[model samples]
Structure formats: C-alpha cells, structure tokens
Target: MKHIIPYIAIILLATVIIYSNAEKERTRITERCQDTFSDAIRTEKKLLIKQFCMQYRQENSPNSLSVEDKKDWYDQNYLIATSPSRHQLDSLFRDGAHKINRNISTAIGYTFNGKNYFSGDESCRKSVIPVQECVYRKDTISTTDIALQAYIHIPFYVPLQNTYTYAVVLMASVALAVCFLYTRRRKKNMTGIPLQELPETGNVTPVIPRKVQTEKWMKLTDGYQWNPQNHMIEHAGKTVILRGEALRFFQKFIVDKHFFLSYSEICRLYHLKEETNGAKDRAYHSIKQLKDNVAELGIEIKSIRGKGYKLLFSHRNRQII
Candidate 1:
C-alpha cells in the first residue's frame, strides 16, 4: 500500500489536468460556432428588411399606374418591419451550420414572438453566447432589442478536440511531476549514514549494522540503564546483553506490578504450549537466564511456590523507576 501511493497521486494529477484543458478547448470551439451562426442570421435578416422596403419605392417608378397609388403604398409599408411577416422571414432563414460540429450533433434556431423556427434538431433552444454576462469570472454577452436569438449547444459532445497543443503540454507536465517524485524518493534511499568520511586503500567499506539513534533509554536503577536499541543493560561500567526469550521476558517484567511473572505468563511470552507437562520447567529456564544476567547488578529473583517469580531489589540497588 505504501509503495502504491506515488502511482495513485500521478494518476489523479493527470486526470484533473486533462479534464480542465478539455473544458477550455470545448469553450473555444463553442465561441467560434456562435460567431458563425450570428453572422449568417444577421446577414439574412438585413436582406429580408431591404426586400420589404423595396416594394414601397417600386410604386413611384414608371411602372406605377398613378401617383395616388404610390402615396397609399408608402403609407402601408412604413411599419412593415415593426410587424415583420414571419412566413416571409422564415423563407430566408436557413440552418447555416454544418450538420455535425466536429462530429458532435449541432442545431441552429431562431426565436421571435415566442415562436421557434429551425431546419435542424427539434431539441435546439435559444441560448446566450458564453452563457453568462461575466463568463470568464464576471462578464456577460451582448444583448439587443431584436427578438431573434440563436441556439448554441453541442449535445453529448465528446472532449476529443482537434487541437493537441494543450493536451501535449499537460501530458509533459504530468510526466515531469511523476519523474521528480520518483527521483526524489530514490535520492532519499541513496542517502544513508556514511559509514566513513573516506574509505581506506580506495576500497568500498562493507556496511556494518548501526544502532538506531534514539533518546529513550529505560532507567532501571540510579546507575543501571537499559539500551533497548542494542538490548544491553549497563551498570557501573559493566554491560550485560540479553537476547531471545530472556530479553522479551525482562521487558515484560519491567511493566508488570510487583515485578512479577507467572508460569502461564512466561509461557505466553515465549509462545510455548500452556498447561502442558514441563511447562513450568520451560518457563523457569527462560526466566533463569534473565535472572542470572541481572544478578551481577545486585538484583535477585525469588520463586513463590505454586504461584510465580518476582524481582527483589536491595536497599543499595533500589529501582529508580
């Protein structure tokens, strides 16, 4: 689990960066499509208004039957744009966009007087370009008195934009990050305690096991201390090393009340079978080794019949803890 942490972090970082860049690219495509749609709609609307006004001017030409009809035609056509003919405008309106926008379904529509008209998908609805007034952070799109608005949505669009510059940069950055993490971890392992500042005879020195540096030492008596890192007890310039089951039982005895150890407790510490023949003898032998080692420091172990063993300290070698 510990070794898998760096790989997990790399995956998450790549995913987030790729997702953010894809969203930015999608936004750019949507804006370009909106501009294209707006230009087509505006140009068509201008042409329709020009045709509507042309009828009025035609009445004053030589083709007109009389001057009285020309005056009446001008009056009737003055407010033609205010109450524009939907059927006439619809004739000019066309779905100017490609059927597929980069392989994603697209539709173009116009809404006027609460009625929608389009030659594409029926699901397309009117929308503001960029969606918000302050789109980037706090801006909005332009608004107009004209009721005509275009539909601009790419339904179920995939994030496979044609441009790859941003994606390339994102991949390169993630690769660098992953490489840096691996390199740093390798450097830490390479840097350990220098066995010696310099080797003799230009030879590499073999690594000797070094005691772990720690501040905690179990104080037994005023002059007796237990160096657990080395499993050695020291007293009066003498050191006694305890190992194996003896060392474990010694450590447990320090924590037990009255410095006591029962036969069953000793068997459990050494993982020996309990309540079996020779169980007491096995427990006694393990405890005897620990007792004999500490006896040099004036500590004695006394046995209680049918019970357990206890460590007894003399007045001169009273326990400090």
Candidate 2:
C-alpha cells in the first residue's frame, strides 16, 4: 500500500496536465474559428453590399437627384438590402456556419435595421451559456447613412462523442495493469517461509540442533551470528555490541519465540514509562539504530504502524541452525 502511493500521485498529476492542455487547445481552436468565421462573414457582407449598391444605382438612376437625396436613397437601399428577416438569417446560419469548422459549435445573431435576429435554437437563446473560452466576434455592416451590427459566438472545441469513452477505457486499463504488477511483485516477495510462523503456545520453542546450541554461536538463515553469552551480534564478518534497551527489546523475540511484539510490551521489558514525553520517540530511535546496526545481516524490523513491529529474516527455515 505504501509503495503504490507515489504511482497513484504520478497518475493523478499526469491526468491534470493532460486535462489542462486539452482545455488550452480547445481555447486555441475556438479563437481560430472566431478569426476564420469573422473574416468569412465580413467578406460575404462586403460582396452583398457591393451587389446591392450596383443594383440600386442601375434601377434608381441617381444622376437625376441632389447630393442629399442621393445619400438618402443609398442609405435606404443599403438598409433594405442588408437587413434580412430572422428566418432568412437562421437559414443562412444553419446552412453556412456548420460547414465553416468541424470542431466548433457556433451561434450567430444580428441587429439589422432596428430588427433583431438570432440563429440559435430556442433553448440556446433562453439559457445562459457559460463563457469559458467562448469566442465572440462582431462586425458592422455600414453604408454612408446607417450601420447594421452582426455578432457570432463560437464555443470551445468539443471532441467527438466517442472520445470520452476511449479515454475512460484507456485510464482504467493503465490502473488495472499497475495493480496487477504490484500484486504479482507482492506475491513473489512472499515465496519464502515467513518468520512469523512460530508456534502459538508460549511454553514451546522451535528446536535448534545440538551443534547450533552447543557452539555458543547461533547462525541465522542469512549468515548472521548471535552470541547470547557475549551479547554481541556479527553480520557480514563485522561484529557490533548489542546492549542497553535495544538488546532487551530484541531479547523479547528469543524469550517468546515470536516475530511480533507490541510497543507496550517492549516498553515494559525495557522499563521505559510509556506515558512519558518522547518515550515512543526514543523507542523508535532505538529501533532505527538497531535496524541500521543489523542491516548487513539481512534482517529487517518493520513497523506495523498503529500496532507494533515485526521481525523478518530473508532466508527460509533451512539455515535456522
């Protein structure tokens, strides 16, 4: 459990980064859509106005009119030509805007010749659209007399409907793969006979051969030797004196022939008051020092956290003598 925390944290961090980048890319795409659509609309308006002015000039024969009258005629014609009805604008948006960009969802609106027109559906017009990364573009259709305003809303990029499903499947696959590997590694590490399997009866101890007991030196499975009489432990050909509270704490394993010992039991054995300030800290320090001292012996003291400690030796029962 402790080993998997870092992996989970890394996966979470990667997910955050991926999501942030996706949003940024979506914003960039929306901005590009705004620029593209704005230009398209402006171009279309210009062409329509040019065509209207040509038709008006041909039909009205402005050469017979005064300067102010000619200005009024041009203005009225421009307004009449550019200000299409709401239905016409809606049809234009439905037919034209959707083809402009495949990634962006668009809505268009206009206030033309004192009339309002919208290209969005009823729900879109009524509901408040959240503006995160929303792109808005407005253009003015102007003649010498009047101007009509046109606006467009380009929403952030939305991926295909299947994208979310694929992402979920991919993430689940990765998590399952990590969990599978961790379980396999844990199972592999447990192949040897566990040192915790001592007899539960307090009166019996596991038998050690006569050669081991008579030699005055007991050899652990991993090649460490302990001499109880001399109070010395040797590991990897180096010997360290084992004494004081640490020695007493370790001696509990021999006395009980058990792997687990609670903190209260160790404190009682070592005559340390458990309620005293820094008592547990001192005990932890002693355990750490003991661990460092015995590292080369292939023996480990694992703290069970909120419980107690367990001793583990690397090899199986073959070298218990």
Candidate 3:
C-alpha cells in the first residue's frame, strides 16, 4: 500500500509537470505562428500578407508565425503567380517541422529528396532573382522543466479597510455643498436692500446749486437779466440765458422790435464766431436751451424749411401774422 501510494504521487507530479510544459509550449507555438512571405504579385496581395503578418506579431508577441499561417500566406499570394497542383501545399504545412537557416538562392531555392513535398525553390523567389530571405525559429525542450506559477486575485467578497482617503473625500464634498448653499442664501438675502442704505464707497461728489436771477430788459448794463417770470415782456418767458457776449450782440441788433432770425443767421450776426472749442460748445448749448425753454411760453417759434426761426406771440385775433 505504501509503495502504491508513492507511485501514485509520482504519477500525479509527472502529469502536472507535463501539463504545465504543454501549456507553455502551446503558448510558445501560438506566439511563433506569425508569418511573412517575401514574393507576392498584386499590390493588394502584398498588403494582405503584410497586414496578416503584422497582426500575428501583434497578437503573439516575442514569437510569431505558425507553419499553418505561413502556408496559408504562401498559398494565397503564390496562387497569383503559380497555380497549386495539390489542394494543399504539403511542403509548407502538415509538417510540425519549421524551416531553419537555409540559403534560398533566389533561382534555385531549397530542396528535399524523394518527396515533391520539399522540391524546387520551396523558398521565396521574385522572378529569376532572389529579393529577400525567410528565416524561421524552432522550439527546443529542456530536461528540467519549471513548474507553472499561479496568480491569485483579491476576493471581491472580502471587506475593505475604511481608509482616511475616503473619509476626507466625503468631508470635502459635504463642505463644498454647504458653502454653495450658504453663498446662494447670502445672495438672496442681500438682493432686497435699497440703494440709499448700500455702502457708499469710491467718490463722494459735491452738489453745485444753480442760481437764476431776474431783471427788466429796458434797463441795460449788459442787458436786464432775461427772466421767464417777468410780466411786461411776456416774451421774457421765451428768453434763455445766453453768453454775455451773444446777449449784448442781440441787444444791438434787436431789429424793429421783431427781427426774424434763422439759427444760422444768429450764428453769423455775432461776429460772435465760434473760433474756440469752448465758444462753439457754449453756443450750441445756449441755442438749444433757448429753443426748448421758449416752447413752453405759449409763443410759437416757427421753422420754415429753407428759411429758419421766427418768434410770434398771439394777441387779439392776429398772431403777429
């Protein structure tokens, strides 16, 4: 019984070693399966072979090119140049053997005796010229085979540790949410405040008061102050404060008590030319103010298309017509 148990253990160990080595060899074989054929006719066929070889290399790195893949490549590309006599290329496939370092003299190629299986330039050839060579690798066995190593993964069902990393992330998320809510509430609370109570920063401007004086036009020392509130010259209501110089010029040219003036004529009559920037700006402001304020005086200032402004106050049934 003891001897039988020892034998059984030995058999089991041998089986395990053999299975591991077979798996390794199969892996190596799969890797070595990548193939590339040298001579090809069509552009498409060449591209196809190149792509197939590349794909095999990518899939089975370190070692690629299997005998079957190599045979397939040759059959597919070679058919364009030469027709196959047999259904299958027996020389390339079928043999678990791989081609070694053999000089494929472009014209002659490699040869195997007795079997047409290894006859002719079994090597790759382009026309009568040898363009490239096809070299292959072989597998060799070692006496002392290594045991297969197993890789174990962490079990999904196991409980994970509560690291400070997860807790810190949770705390930061909560703080951010609270900060956003607080900011939103603050904005809502402050939106209702009136402008007067708001903080006064930046410039605090001083307010300048405008004083308007009244006088009669008859008495003149720079002409009576033009008052809109005067009773006699109800037309005074139509008067606006003009530059002291423009007012003096108007007094001199108060033609026949009612001189109709065009806006342009007024600009001309005053040798009161707007040569200076300040003078032109003031003149425009004065005229605009006169026209606007006089409109409220019940007196109509008429604009005659090609002509200009004429002032007329209504009295009796005649409107200074």
Candidate 4:
C-alpha cells in the first residue's frame, strides 16, 4: 500500500489537469459558438435586408412612402429573419457552425412570445441536447407585440493532441520506465555474480583471510565467512542472506553454541514447551532453513537421532583435512 502512493498521486494529478483543460475547452467552444452565430446572422441579415429593400423600393416610390408603409415593410422583414421554421433554423445553424469549425455539430432552438415555437434536437427541448458536449443560446426580438427569440448553439471538442492528454500520457510512460529500470537494477544486485562466471579458487590462504576478520565477522575455516550483523554467509564470492527463523537460529548459535544444541536447548531458545512435537518441528524447520542458506559454504545441520543437532563440514570444505 505504501509503494502505491506515488502512482495514485500521479493518477489524481492527471485527473485534475484533464478536467481543468476540458472545462477551459468547453468555455472556449461556447464562446466560439456565440461568435459564429452572431457573425452568420449578421452577414445573412445584410443580404436579406438588401434583397427586401430592393423589393420595397420597387413596390413603393420614396416620394410616396408613408409611416405605415415603412412599418409594414419592417415587420415583414423581421418575420423572415426571426420566424423561420425548425428545418430552416437547423439548416442555418448547422451550416453556420460548420463553416467556422468543420467538425462541430449544432442544433437550433427558437421561442416566440415566450412559447417554444421550434426546437431542433429532442434533448435541446429538455435541457442539454443528446450530446454531452453542447452549449445553448437564445435571444429575444420584438417584431411588433410578440417577443421572438432565435436560439442556436455549437459544440466543439478538444483535439487529440491537446495539452492535458499529451502531458498525462508522457508522464505515465516515464513513470513506468523508471519503475522497470529500478526493479531490474535491484534484481541484478540481489543475484550477484553467477558461479559459472567465477574464477576458480586457489588453495587455502589462511593468513590473508584471518587478518580480515573482526569480532563481528568470523572466518569459518578458509573460504567461508560468517557476517553476524548481516546474518549472511559468503563463500567463493557468493553471498546469501539467512531469512526469518534461519536468522534467529544462527544468532543463537553464534552466541551459545559449543558445536551442538540439544532438542531441549532449542526448545528453550524458541520458547516452545518441552516434551512436545511442536518444539522438535520448530527446531527442525529453523535448522533446515539455516542449513539451506549456508549450503554454498558446505555447512550442514546434522540431526542426532533421539538427541538434537550439530553443524558439520564435509571433508572437501574443511581446510585442515
């Protein structure tokens, strides 16, 4: 659980960054939709106004123009601009939004005199449209008495190569690479030098090895050394750490051994009740573990039937022999 902290932190940080960027992008798209709608409407209005103006001028001469006539003309043009049907509104919005951003999708909504006159998308009829990424806008226009509103919205997206997505992916890749290298290096260190690659050991050099020992490190025989602090044995450039019960057994052995430990003595050391199979099993398992860890040193824990255990060396590893 402790080791998982850094990755968890990275994930949370990535989430925040991505969310922040998405919100910023949504806001940007909303504003862009507003701008695009205004521009398209403004441009379209200019053309419509020019076309109607020409028709009005042709129908009624400037000299004969009356207040009613001008008002009537304004009313007709306003209806044409604001009161287009659902199909027309959708086409206008879609085309207008796409002109600005080719990938964008748009829906039309309109209300006249406070009643929903036209709504394009079904979800737009309710709240947000069918799509999650969308923005809405509605504006009121007074033709004469009734209030007319033209509603439109555009929805854009964050591009694939946007800042937040790229940043998170890059960070994840780097983190994985670092973890892999760290594990590989640790594994290599623990494995040490392989025996097949080792140089052959010469005959025993008693003087040189004896000089290297301190009170805490015992040079057992010749090539094998017992490092008490580390609970390890080193022989012929190979090292092994004694683990758990094995370590405890070795510690007791170093302090109390006179070459052997009776089964009762082992039981006392481990606080196991005497005259029980548990004590014998505990002693047996621990010594077995100790024996395995020091196998490279050719040290063995020999069980004495109906008695206890003693450490022994095969003739090949006993320098004097």
Q: What is the lDDT of residue 230 in candidate 1?
A: 84
TM-score to native of every candidate shown:
0.33, 0.36, 0.20, 0.40
In model 4, which range of ten residues has the least summed lDDT? 131-140
| Highest TM-score model number | 4
Ranked candidates, highest lDDT first: 4, 1, 2, 3
Flag regions of model 3 displaced more than 4 Å. Answer: 1-253, 270-285, 314-318
Q: Which structure is stronger by lDDT: 2 or 4?
A: 4
Better of 1 and 4 by TM-score: 4
Once fitted onto the true fold, the runs of candidate 1 whose alpha carbons sit more than 4 angstroms away are 46-100, 114-146, 155-158, 163-321
The alpha-carbon deviation from the true structure for residue 193 of candidate 3, after best TM-score superposition, in angstroms, is 92
Instruction: Look at candidate 1 and give me any clashing residue pairs.
Output: 133-139, 133-140, 134-138, 134-139, 134-140, 135-139
lDDT by residue for model 2 over 46-80, one digit each (tens)? Answer: 54555433323435553433343344345434534
Give the per-residue lDDT digits (tens) of candidate 4, residues 1-321: 544676677677777877677776665555445444444444554544554532334355434333543443354347445655544435665676676557665664444344444445565655433221111112112332222233434333443337677877788778867866876687688686654555788888667554565547687656667887777777878888887667877766655434566777776764545645535544554575587577776677767888877666556754442
Candidate 3: how large is its RMSD? 46.6
Clashes of each: 6, 0, 8, 0
Please list the residue runs of candidate 4 whose C-alpha ends up more than 4 Å from where it truly belongs after superposition. 51-77, 80-83, 86-89, 127-164, 183-321
Please give, for residues 156-185, the per-residue lDDT of candidate 3 as tens digits: 211122243345445556655665677679
**Global Cα lDDT for candidate 2:** 0.52
Pick the lDDT winner: 4
